[model samples]
Target: MTATIHRLGRDQAPSLEPMMALVAEDMNSVNAVILDRMQSRIPLIPELAGHLIAGGGKRMRPMLTLASARLLDYSGTRHHKLSAAVEFIHTATLLHDDVVDGSGLRRGRKTANIIWGNSASVLVGDFLFSRSFELMVEDGSLKVLKILSNASAVIAEGEVNQLTAQRRIDTDEEQYLEIIGAKTAALFAAACRIAAVVAERDEKQEQALDAYGRNLGIAFQLVDDALDYESDGATMGKDAGDDFRDGKVTLPVILAYARGSADDRAFWKAAISGHRISDEDLTHATGLLRSTGAIADTLARARHYGQRAIDALGMFGNGKAKAALIEAVEFAIARAY
Candidate 1:
């Protein structure tokens, strides 16, 4: 998002130049295909969809789909369909997420739920989800359909589980992993696996892509969790304390709660579990997180997953595409800082 962390000004940050070039080389073309698919005979649907699509998502899911396909030298056009399908699924999830989280902002702008009414946002989200299925059907790939459908189901289940798990100070690392894997990594895994389906690649290659996506997605979400504890609106593109305020369970707070002293844990129980948090309560919670080194520790775990994602690419042959995959891994972790 923000030039992959550097000492110089954002304008002079080194990572964006190469990252942009690689993205253009690998993703820009497919992005156009994605745009084309979003068009419908009904003009308003397309227009509303366009507004969200052009909003500030990094489009990493679609990029992964396209790049994974390219890595296997997929020469077929169906990858475009699959890529667009992945983007549609992702956009649909974001729309649903805004409603579920009751979020007012994303990427420093009002969320779809805030701009359009929640009803319009929900319907538009459903439309995008249906469009994704349509694209998959047109591609005539049953495997792709199964993969994405399963991911969608898992995402929904994960959201429900996470909602129940929220503010429960006793939630463990295993539960945290399960929640993130279900809600975030499921789609990432599907995105990469569908590319293998399009390429008709070998089983081992497909597994590698799955592993890459799973680990990368885990890393990405972990960084996001850390950002809620460590970042401001300027860097994070959303209000700080939104996660805790929404009663969402995330890694840093989970870690802090686990390792905190008796008084600190009691404080969390009052503020988080008892739903007693105020502005002052948020500052106190952040202080507890800082004292426990929870944010730093969570970031270390995210970096480990990011490294695993890069290593998972070893099964693939050497190429610019492979390099791009590696860069993607680094980019996922870099966003934490």
Candidate 2:
């Protein structure tokens, strides 16, 4: 796939509303299942879980599940509950991630970890994982169970892999892809793939959906990493320099460091080693990223993956579902700007 990017302002760019509209009614059913399953006699269960659940997240993963099913022209209501399962898994991961990263803000609001504490966040994450498994079990498709369960395992492995690579400036592009493919793309693949199983489609169709979600997931993450430095706190919903302050060696840093002068390399080594993290340091880092063409190149890579995602849908016929899915790819790439 040729990665051609057409830059557009937020107002004129592709929107997610089309996809959301296509699945709006189905999402309501999924939301009902999510609300019902999150409840517990303990009371704290729903409170903490709901905190993030009700947060301003776009519910993209679950929406992918519903949209993929719609692309197959699924007639039954089975995708709704399964979509909730996908969401629970996603929310659980976010909770655990905030604690691991010691994050303070998400979607312009205080994180559950910050409000509820580390142990509470971790336990609630586990509870959500349990709820996801229960929903998967009720679906009674062994293939679906295996797909989602394996994704859960893969995500754990990816988290561990990222932890080891953290603050290590030597982490390469290939390894970074592997880490994100597991942590972020695995569930995305499963979320779309299961729709094929429920819709009783063949393996070819299932593989196509998996590819669509996987490529889109990678594109989504690359854009997020680029925005960590380029976007403001209000635009990003997290601190603008969170990755820099936390000593996370994302793609921008990796590329900048690789292409830097001796002094610039020293600066990067110091920055990723938990030093040089003041506001001015972040400013300097952003300048280095621009000078090295790292930010621009990172966005270019995202467009590559986004194009692959759009290409993965070529087998599907032209229709509202296909159009919305294609525009979703456009939106993901557009977010970096």
Candidate 3:
């Protein structure tokens, strides 16, 4: 049987800005901490970090940290520092990822590596990683430190796993899910879990928040993978078919490849095997993804995870924060549209 695929519309998903407004006050504090911590005696450190930090990308991860904290009514200053740490970790990953992926653009601007060379990008990424650890240490919570620290390690492992799986057509859906979970979702889970820890909420609450983040992260990455094939440079902040050009086996490719005919499989095997891929190849691949319902199926999978993210919020009381958090899931899924 063929899979039923669902497509998202422009008005179908909720906006993230309203959800962000729900924690506008706390997010201001988090932003303050972020700017204050990015400073350095070495001119290049701040210059390079600031270039990316000020690039107008949505600060979603740190927003999650602050929103999670506020959801439990934690009126403490420590969450500020934790949220900044989350941003640092996220920024560091972007720096390193650009280098690893040889990306030239991010947030519709030149990537750090493209401007400053690979060494500078990599070192700056290291600097951000160290800064994140320092913030965790300053927070004085062993549990928070452990959660964020483990997330950092798991993210690295996920990067390596993705590297190992690169260009391999045999990469399965389960393996792809594992890679995204560790690389993207681990930090989301940590960010949400730390909020509960700081609030001194029960283990059940902590786990619930973690589950929400984990599922939300999966949905977010799935949409991102789909967008790489569907969006233009203006909308997606990068060129379309980047994943295909880079030989990265994202879910859209996986689903399409799995469901394709013999001739279709051969086409994918050649296109994804790191050969010289032309624009025409990408156009053809997009057609195949559409014809085989890969893009729609991928979005369907994102919706599934998005619903799980919403369900995970059932433990929280009904309020602006809870409603905003649920809407945030829809926003994450709607980016593709």
Candidate 4:
């Protein structure tokens, strides 16, 4: 079979700055809430949390919450707290993930676990998780509480599911989708749906936004998976080939393993079987991904999900927020470039 290489042209992919600009004012409010809620009398609590929070991520999840609220013309303060809560939940997951993965870098900086030790990182993660619940309670809406709280639980389940799939060469597309959906996309769905809920919108609108966020999150993770093979560490904000080293069975690996030649399959099976992966092994793995169209196929799946995310916004009327949300889908897929 011939490989179909996917190339990202410069003009085709727009920057994420516009999405951030569209919701700039609201994101500012979300940031304020994040800083305020992260504070505590104990210096270490704030210190550890701030370390990761300050290590600038795109803040995509919280921005989705803000933009989703704006899409529905929600003129309330409650979404602010909820957005911060979403961010806290995301950050808590990152802390725990670093510990689980034994990762030393995040967002191009030292991971909290590396700087503060695994014990502090784990404890701080728990603190942030509790802090997220506190924000939910402060919102005083049982419905909103249910959505976000359920998302947190789903995120945990996804992580465990991925752990179960780790280093297993036989992991397939369905299992990979389940892992990303639970680990990453669940919160995205909740973040967007809660906006419609706060606005007192009907169930249809809530479901639409939920669909949008869920598909976008899936696309986002697919791109990350591909980027692990294709990107330099600078672009990915983590070590290049981190997934290969960790024996994580992401979509790229699944597709490559399924399509590879006999020798190629053997190489992959050994590389990801929890053995010591040399630099040369990673180089060969990347070559197979490129030559077998795994990266392209993975990116095609991302674009598929991105289009679904855009389609989910059809119920909403035309406005800057709506347009920006659509562009956000483009940005999510384009990030791999």
Candidate 4 achieves a global lDDT of: 0.90
Error of 4 at 173 (Å): 0.5
Local error of candidate 3 at residue 67 (angstroms): 0.8
lDDT of 2 at 137: 91
Worst 10 residues of 2 by lDDT: 1-10
Per-residue lDDT of candidate 2, residues 13-87 (tens digit): 799999999999999999999999999998888999998999889999999999999999999988888999999
Decoy 1 TM-score against native: 0.91
TM-score, per-candidate, Cα-based: 0.91, 0.96, 0.96, 0.96
**Model 2 ranges off by over 4 Å:** 1-11
Give the Å shift of residue 68 in candidate 1: 1.0
Off by over 4 Å in 4: 1-12
The clash count for each model shown is 0, 0, 0, 0
Per residue, candidate 4 scores C-alpha lDDT tens digits across 26-133 of 888989999998999989999999999988888989899888988988888888888999999999999999999999888999999998999999999999999999
Give the Cα RMSD of candidate 4. Answer: 4.7
lDDT of each: 0.81, 0.91, 0.90, 0.90
RMSD of 2: 2.7
Which segments of model 3 are wrong by more than 4 Å? 1-13
Position 57, candidate 2: lDDT: 90
Mark the 10 consecutive residues where model 4 has the least summed lDDT. Answer: 1-10
Lowest summed-lDDT stretch of 10 residues in model 1? Answer: 5-14
